[model samples]
Target: MLFDLTDLRLFIHIAESGSLTRAAERMHLSLGAASNRVKELESRFGMRLLYRENKGVQLSPAGEALLIHAQQFMQQLERMKSDMQQFSSGIKGHIRIFANTTAVTEFMPQVLGSFLARHPQVNVALEERLNADIVRGVAEGTADIGIAAGPVQGQGLEIINFSTDRLVLVTPREHALAGSGRIAFADTLAYAHVGLHEGSSLWHFLSRIVSQSGQRLELRIRVRSFEAMCLMIEADVGIGILPQSAALRHSQTMGLALVELDDPWAVRERSIVVQSLDALPHYARELVEEIRAGQAPRAISPDRNA
Candidate 1:
């Protein structure tokens, strides 16, 4: 027997809501109309689809079997519709992105601003996460794209080099090392260092540098965020090595000084990562090009100006 698509939709809705009354309310249909649809479906199949219970309606064995296939079919149909809409509208669709804190605060604004100006119809959603989490979001299909300090390891991910950023030592203006140019890593390590927690990417980068130099980093306090590290540095707790983007944003306004690290590992490559290189959507490709072509230079250091 042939069943209407609307009948399948109604069945799925009823199964989801677990009540004929609630399903009718959700579909904005009269209770009689909703009941008729379910009755018609059960009659056509020659089986009991639902059974009334004290808590709510429960799907019968036959109903449960049909519900699974119905839901999958509906999802695929919706995806197809969305794809056609995007193609017909010339790259107008919602694109969700995950970025690190430094990228969100400093780098992304200019790039996203320009893109939005050019493609006014497209909607963009952004979330700030840790570098590792950003990579995971893209890999897990939670985000369409991601921007991070370095390429994270995962199969089926296409990582393209977009830019480079440097880590700088930030201190209060009156600190003895404030005016110094390119402060040696050894000198900074001698003093108490305000840094992020050991597990953080920033901490890992610095730890690797110190380990290679045959010295252990002396940590005065471990903060969970770049903002907290800056605040502690401002309070003269210790010096901090923070992303240049983050450092420059607050250094001038907060009356803090930023110095370059002499260590070789101070600079990091920033990249745009996507799930699949072969099956990228048109808008995704455009966004990747925009990121690579429009990346800004790293924040200026005292030595560069002097």
Candidate 2:
């Protein structure tokens, strides 16, 4: 049976609003026209989709199924349109990448800037995601590439060592911990902490570790980006744990002191993940080569507190 996208969208609106009249108003259609469209959908499906109620409407069993598929269909279509818009704008290629927060905030800007400078026809869509989500997105073809730290496990994915980053604790120059050159993550929990906002990849990662450490992270406040967290720390709001590179970079302008974390997990070995290198488009393969060429061992300068 064939169902139109417009009708499917209307049905979704009706399902969400629980009122056909409201759905009609939202879709800019008359109530009668909306009712007829729903009726037409029911006729095409050969089954009752929604159960009319005095209050509004409820989805029948068949309606629930249709709603699930309709939402998926609409989402896929929207993604297609977004990808196609790049071409319409004279972009020759599009690449989607999902990576961990550190890579997103610390590493990708220079890499992407250089790559885009060399390939003006290419466009990239990058999202910061947790390591597990990055692996899954690459494996499911939701993203063309993924950059995440190690302990990554996924079938049919080619993993290449991308870079290494260390997590360090940053504090104001006069904070109690600022006198120490190295401290364990658990020890930092004793003081008020500045952290990335909840639902951020770093937030989730730190939460998991705190759970494992059998201690709670005493978060005084949460900010959106690493630089914001650093600013908060510099203001003596709270101590923060961030990638070493970021801490060192911010220390140049801010009076923040960096203290190395004793925990082994503090050091992360990031990797570039792809379903298949050879299977990627020519432009994608070139970008991959660019990323690979950019990989090099970085030497950490002495911590400020040291």
Strongest candidate by TM-score: 2
Q: Which portions of model 1 miss their true places by more than 4 Å?
A: 1-92, 184-186, 195-232, 299-306
What digit string (tens of lDDT, one per residue) describes model 2 on residues 1-306? 577888989999999999999999999999999999999989988999999999999999999999988887898788889888878999888899998888788868988998899889999999989888899889877799999875788887899886777888899988888888679888888899999988687788889999987888788999999899999999999999888888888888999888888999988887899999999999888888887787665544665774
For model 2, state the Cα shift of residue 96 in Å. Answer: 1.9
Model 2 poorest ten-residue lDDT run: 297-306
For each candidate, what is the lDDT? Answer: 0.79, 0.87
Instruction: Report the error of model 2 at residue 181, Å.
Output: 4.2
Instruction: Name the Cα RMSD for model 1.
Output: 8.3
Q: Report the poorest 10 consecutive residues by lDDT, candidate 1.
A: 297-306
| Clashing residue pairs for model 1 | none
User: What is candidate 1's lDDT per residue for 161-202, written digit by digit as tens?
Assistant: 777888788888888888887877788877888988765656
